[model samples]
Target: MSTISAQAALLPTFSEVQKAHRRSDVLILDRHGELIHELRVDKTGRRLEWTKLKDVSPALVKAVLQSEDRRFYEHGGVDWKAVGAALIDRFFGSKTRGASTISMQVAVMVQRGGRPLGHKTFRQKWDQMAAARELEKSWKKDEILEAYLNLVSFRSELQGIAAASRGLFGKEPSGLDLKESCTLAALIRSPNALPAVVGQRAALLAQSLSPGEPGEAYRRTAIDALSRPYRLRPYLALAPQVAKILTAGAGQGELSAQTINSTLDLRLQRFALQSLRQQLDLLQGRHVGNGAVLVVDNATGNILAYVGNSGDSQVDGIVAKRQAGSTLKPFLYGLALEKRLLTTASVLDDTPLHISTERGIYMPHDYDHRPRGPVTVRTALSASLNIPAVRTQLLVGTEPFADRLRRVGFDLRRSAEFYGFSLALGTADVSLKELVNAYRCIARGGIVSPLHLTPGHSGRTLRAMDPKVAYLVSDILSDPGSRSVTFGLDNPLTTRYWTAVKTGTSKDMRDNWCIGFSRRYTVGVWVGNLSGDPMWNVSGVSGAAPVWLEVMNYLHGNVRSAPPPRPRGVVAARVPAGHGEAERGELFLAGTEPPSVPAARPAGEAWHIARIAYPPDGTIIVIDPDIPEPNQRVFFETENEAPGLKWRLNGELLPPGEEGRRWAPRVGRYELALVDNGGKVQDAVSFEVRGQNQ
Candidate 1:
């Protein structure tokens, strides 16, 4: 047997050797700095895990030595006895036995395209031996052993002792048992062997290691251990996000073993994921295939939990743009209230109404297609009534409403005219992230700020709405009595604590959303098909509100989201029995009060007259041809419910003593007038009804 000459052998520098041993792995940590996930492969798709000798198991080191080179500690790199025996066996036409030491294997591992026992020429073999000797001289025994164990491939898709220990044994290298160690050592020769064959080989190796004793039990145990299926932490779902955080944009770098401290709370993340998955599973028969959830800290705007999807669909529901249903109504009403266009006690007509725009004839209807007549602004908003919201939008104007949405962090890429009046009902597309932050804006008392993902992240804050208006809107949303008209007294939106939540469903129930905030956290959830297919009989409350409630309840725990303090410019007024119906309390801007409201008018007085209430001067109401004539009506009301009030349309007298009347309108401009029994015109307004069908 010939030995490699030390004088002719080239040695690698310590730094070069260290660089050769470097492997790529990314570790994702939770907010508390605990490991949540690990990326164990480099960009080149190589499984290189650089483990320190101290972190490696001595048992694995001993097993590798016993399996590959029994005298690894004594040899420079070439085992002359084994090499000579292999050469003589080759000459005699017998099977060749391995004489490659761990150091030689490590040299092969580091060399480009080098592999164990691969095809090679005589000169290449000599060079490999010389390089192994050089490596042994450069690195200590422990380092050499650690490098070999980490660099060598154990089985199919298993590289390094750490990968083998996890991919094969479902554990860290330090936790490998004697049976597992022997089994892994046996796998070094043939990693892709069948489980039964692997068990047999591992059993033989274990018995050979203890030749004199009865080793059947140890062999069976090692074989059994090797045959078990591999297990790993259930963190594969978070791998893509970790990759994005580490390798996207400014973090672009070569893939290597890396540890990233993420802002995720594993507990909360697991809960959110489980909640979404459970809902998806329950609704699977309904063709519900995707869902996402986001939880943010209202104080810091830190995302506490983020579940991108609960199904196999690759779509990211959080950032994907979908229609914002009635979810945008709160902001619309808030804008109206902030402008003092309407007070909480102000009544709006929820009866059938149609509008004409450049787009076509626009007709808005409630979810149930049932009219709620003369409801207060608070109840109208809380019940998510369509007509009331449309009326409020008419008062607030579409341009200003779209601007308000943009100011509050909604991305309204189009002009106000692009959406027209349908904008009031949320016809525009928006992302879950933008919508959640907008709700967080209201939660933060009218301030718009971006959500922070990592610690120490700063954000710019802008006042998007008045704090008093925000407070009033929040109060109205929290009132069970207000929402009871639609969602009922006990639904998923009703929390044990105070939570102002709004639910919305896009056209044909393609997207459902339920977003709200507690005293501390704001959670938003979206459940729908990524393909944009309509859901089967799914409403906003049933589809998304339950998940929102689950996550909100989980976040709040036992604490309640208390009511926000009243802002400075807000006042609570008690309307007298005679002026306001039911004498209920109302919230209004300090200086914006109803004018000239008398407690009671004098009886039998000529001045005690009524004026036309509905179609208040210059009102342009459109009649949709799509709506049947019987379902269409122009309502006329008297300002005061006087007993002798009379109504007339186009100078044609209607029934006497009629305080209010419904005119089944046709396509024409009509003059409406209200007069008392004294033949005095109390009020007169000219309105036009135009019809168009698309």
Candidate 2:
């Protein structure tokens, strides 16, 4: 036996690399199995992935053996014949040809971590031969060949047969033909060789192998093919987020994912991006440099298209937190309805009002700077009147309203006290995803479902609000007539199909947003500068609503947004005339409908009105310490006077004829009671007078 052969038998064999091989790139595939994007580098830092020997093309395998190490199968490990020839050539000072067999190369690649074989000493060659012989005893020839192909470097920063095949030919190893195989084989010896040299060698080899074919006349097919630019879907913006969820899961170990089957449709993504870019192109002069669009399936909560940013902004606006503006009004109104504090037909004063706060006085006004007198809750919400929203928040306390928004999937990230009443005007920051999901809750009958990016992930759905109230809010938003008070009838929000949408512009016009949902899809769009710069005269209707309309029209090309069926516990009632506007049809919770009142009082014997009229029940009367004691007295009044009526303050009897009588206010609770001659209480109310008037 040869001396090199004797030394090779002393090394250990490795059979684990085959079973544990994985790709470094996390490929993202669309619903139709088309490649969308690839996370090119994994956590391990190496792009090495195992490819099975059986899956490799036999033509490429033959080409490699013929080019690198012929008689590979005939020899045990070290090819002594070629080694002796190489040594003799070196001794004679002649150019040396190849000597190491495929097995020897595999040993060096696997053991040395793919160190390039630029120039090696005889000792290194000897050690590689030893490892090769040892590997032969326990591993098959196919296994050794597979390991070598996967470990060998094909070019600069490009390693493994799979990467070479994809990077150079845009194909898999199994798809390589004889000509392509010969080219790949030539690259194995000199990956950095000039194109002409590599092409000549490959063509000559291909001709020698298949004399019948016209390969000698062929041009540099592989080099020419690689020169063409490769275009891929621009979905890198979503990679970091998608990778985190796919890699480390319950049963799946860290980075176990090879590919992510995303719910995004590549075609729709392209269209949505085009729509946003087209709109942004027109606004370039206005310094509008960024925008984002998100579309989700209302039925399944699957995110169909998520464009993080359209104008090359590194920041991902889809999940970026920004001030929510009037987009939050729907939830506020819905909460009011759920608490029975207000209804669709309830009247709200949209006039300017000042609210006292520790910092200073807060006065809210309508966006148009005009008061909408006694607008119904429906008109106020649909018009997105700032004053009415603030007033509504007053009725439904600030802290409770903030908590309701948080429970409905908005990431407030701070206590309600931090935001205060301005939260009604959407001072709170929220991501487009959170806002869309919160709106989706309304579309799904008040059920909040997470937006799923990957397929087969069924998120938990929770009831965030009463379905009936959500339905009423949706009805109000869908009414074009109500919104016409601000947006006009022919605005972009008026879709042919029934869609409930709202437009909001943040303070200083830093952000403009249009978020809405149809029966099947919820689309949210934001148009603004990513740097937080204010826009030039851009409102939500002109900024984001047009893009939203384009996407919605494409989505509903053949379909329509039909109104949802009325759920149980919802009743249709006629709202009395003389309200803000005649309620075409009012929806009310079955038992919460307003009581029927006669248009006129009964004629006769001086009808008496019951209940206290002044210092209305539940009123938090603020005492003015600056005013004189007599001037601060609160006047008490009744709708009508009755015989034998006497007044009692905090259960203490007072003089009769309390009508028009004034009582001094104090910083405490007072229960005012009216009794008849029998001492039976006819009317009573407990009201608190607190806080020294500012």
Candidate 3:
């Protein structure tokens, strides 16, 4: 305890000291400042204001002092009964009570601006006493009481009654009640800073304040514990964090005005939070781990929902920059296609290719490392073939590739040298928000709408590439039947009018992501730990795809995704390559379909089926060629090499088999007949099959 000079004594109110002791006040606000959350963050345990001991709620004040310093009023700015008790103990017995009082606490706290007890000494105590006397003389009794309530320290970081009210009750001073007051009383003893101890302290204080009130004692304990989590007021819990970040950026000024009016909608924020937690949990269960997610409206580029990381505690989140992975493939391809350098139907090799650009020759592989030779560009795009993306980057030029990413909002120039082969693999680092917005450009008809925190505010759109080319890319992404979106690639372009997506993984495997969008909303997610150490086997699909799917499905109006508008450049053609019955009469593009779409039937519920199309072991061939009835004779084509393979649909099995497999009479509720080598029948696999066009 340092001395408060005589000059300091002249300043009795100690307003400077008082102001210094003030902590960060909890702010409450709604989407539009309608009061959604509130809280207080006390950096100091001492906050003092003056209210007369009598003017204050006697029950509350009494509960605190009785629960804390029992001989408070009788002592002259000091608790001597406890002092005598301690002196008798230490000098005569074992003194434990340290001589400190409400007035003396106010003295040292105001004079020294509140310091720890380790510095308590005669000089500090005398200065504190001198200051307390000065404060008491000019200030009313109630003011003294209020000042003590505001300034006294109870326990570790638990100061003044107001702070205690917030730290314990999540409410303001006016809202403090009898139970809350008693709880604060108990806290003054230890403030162990532990909610439970505060509660027990409250109980003990209640016992001292009202010796026989058992109910009050019980209520004190219950009330103290209830205050823990609520200590973080609602707004303090959610949006104030936004304010903290924003305020740091703003010059000294009113933070509330700048923050409350931001474009973020509380409802949408809630939707984003709930959406992330639920889906991420599901993703994590599948060993996918954590990531960041951001959703924006294509119509306004307003960030409807922005989740920075998998969780608040995660490191590589919305704010963190990491590898963009294969998700960047579409934008680059879109740039090329927009330039008329390529078309949706153009042939791009999924086969191994060495692109020796000015930088280096890049080699890439498909996700499964499986090479399907000579697939169309449509197939390559649909399947997210790494080789084609690498080739396109080389053809497009690495400088242009980097420029396009920047145009779309990614900051990749810092590491210009790493933009060649690694470009296809998203080696360049970008934030989740940046990648999501880049993809949002495709969803918005090739319009690049930069995002903002405030809605009414708008930004200039840069025509980084042509609409036709971007549309071509999206057209491919939105087509499930496109050459690239294959059956093996779980993420297929949807025609339900709602979806298109791509995922990425950061370098060394620390971060995995899934970024997708529809006509209305775009979402991005990243999952990884803080240490930059990639979780084992975590990839874009394995880690982020499931969560992305869940959230996308939710945001897609809880319905299937719809395809993009068909570009005129893409026209249905009856090609000369197809002749007679030997030549199939299926719709084919002039060149080739975009690789992003997997060949599949029209997007609808019936096609997904009840089961067996879930990759069945046997194929179904109609036995009667002329059959038109629902109950046509269908034979099971069980490849002889697939023996011991069982066939089942919808739970009903076929006739018993010699070894373990059998056939069914109908398509619905069919299960394969099974018998093991030990003469024991294996359990059936149920599935459903429908009409050819279904």
Which candidate number would show the highest lDDT if scored against the true structure? 2
Q: Is candidate 1 or candidate 3 better by lDDT?
A: 1
Best model per TM-score: 1
Per-residue lDDT tens digits for candidate 1, residues 1-694, read 3445542244554456556654445666778977555554444323545667787777766666788899888888888888898899989999988777777777766665335667777877887788887777767887777667776777765677776777666678888766777778888888777766766666676666766645455467556655666544433445345345554542223544356666677788889888988988888888788888998888888877877778555467788899999999999999988888888888899998889887778889999999978888878988899888998889999999999999999899999999988898889999999989999888888988888666777688888889878888887877655687788754788665667888898998899999888778888999998889989888888899889989988877866655566666666555544322345445666666555443232222221124456876567888787888888887676554555657878887876533338678777888876655544444567788887741
**lDDT ranking from best to worst?**
2, 1, 3
Candidate 3's TM-score: 0.61
- Model 2 lDDT, full chain set: 0.77
TM-score of each: 0.74, 0.70, 0.61
Kindly state the number of residue pairs that clash in model 2: 1
State, as a TM-score between 0 and 1, how close model 1 is to the true structure. 0.74
lDDT of 3 by residue, 527-637 (tens): 776556656676666676666665666666655444455544344322122111111112223234434443332322111111122223333433343565655544443
Model 2 agreement with the true structure over 357-442: per-residue lDDT tens digits: 98899998888899978988878998899998999899999988998898899978899888989999989999899989999999
lDDT winner, 1 or 2: 2
* Alpha carbon lDDT of each predicted model: 0.75, 0.77, 0.56
Q: Among all windows of ten consecutive residues in candidate 2, which has the lowest summed lDDT?
A: 598-607
